[model samples]
Target: MAHLLFRLRHVTEEEAAEVRALLDEQGFDVYETQAGFFRLGVDAIWLADTRQREAAEAALDTYQQARLARERDAFEQARARGEAPTLWKRFLAHPVQVALTLVAVVVIALLTLLPFLGLATP
Candidate 1:
């Protein structure tokens, strides 16, 4: 059948499972593919048939929005309970993510500075 149409990134295995359950519940044929090679996959890729594209998209969008709302509510509840999350907890929890973020920041700064340094003026 038609698979490998669309995908998502940065979602955990549990999240992917939840999304798969949701899609199945909505009667959409869906599956996941490995998006990267390493200790951890980059993310899960959700696939659907070409014929199911429109409905699949709508369901995924709704599910993601609902998940976002749930996360926002959880954050608000944590703040109300005086258990606010720490910045370091958010950023440095994954060493790979932290290192990649630093690299990205450095690359962006260098790119931004190059034009100001007259390296691109002609």
Candidate 2:
């Protein structure tokens, strides 16, 4: 029986490609499935040989650790250069959009609390 090896949802194309390459290099019998029109199915990689699950999982774990380290280093470099995205930067980039979002949040909060506040006043 095939065992699910990895979920592809929310994974970037580059990351998916790299994972496919890694599994191929490790000689794992793998197949990919796609979520259909209704998105009822899972988008994932499956291992045809359940016996290889442990070894395949180990390889994926190592690859993920390396990828995480690389991403962290890149993010740190960006932050050091003052290029990493921040809320202030976003506000500055689109002041109107930020203001509108803030207004919407305040409105939603007020609406959500209004009933409770009325109950407390009695």
Candidate 3:
């Protein structure tokens, strides 16, 4: 029986390529499924041999941990350098759009809650 190894939803192309390369390098018999027409199918990696599932899972876990650490470090570096966006920065960059979005959000929230609030008041 084939074992699902990884899900591909929201995965970046670089990440997918790295995963494929890692699986191939580890000599695991694997196959991939595409999210076919209308995105109905599962997009995932499957192991052909169930016996190799444990090893493949371990490899993937290790890779994910390292990637997570690397990403966190990069984010921290960017933040330290003031390259990461802050609320003030975003508002400065697009004040009008941000104000309009905030207004729309408040309007939608009020519209959604007004009926419930009215019932509770009585």
lDDT of each: 0.73, 0.98, 0.96
TM-score of 1: 0.58
Q: Residues 1-122, candidate 1: write the lDDT tens digits.
A: 55553456755767777877887788876666664567364344445567888787787788889989998999999999967767676675677888888999999998989878895567
Give lDDT: candidate 2, residue 102.
100
Indicate whether candidate 1 or candidate 2 has the larger TM-score. 2
TM-scores for every candidate against the unseen true structure: 0.58, 0.91, 0.85
Off by over 4 Å in 2: none
Candidate 2: worst 10 consecutive residues by lDDT? 113-122
Clash counts per candidate, in order, are 0, 0, 0
Off by over 4 Å in 3: 94-97, 120-122
**Worst-scoring 10-residue span by lDDT in model 3:** 113-122
How many angstroms is residue 75 displaced in model 3 relative to the true structure, after the best TM-score fit?
0.8
Q: lDDT per residue, candidate 3, 16-103, as tens digits? A: 9999999999999999999998999899999999999899999999999999999999999999999988888999999999999999
Maximum-lDDT candidate: 2
In model 3, the Cα lDDT at residue 55 comes to 95
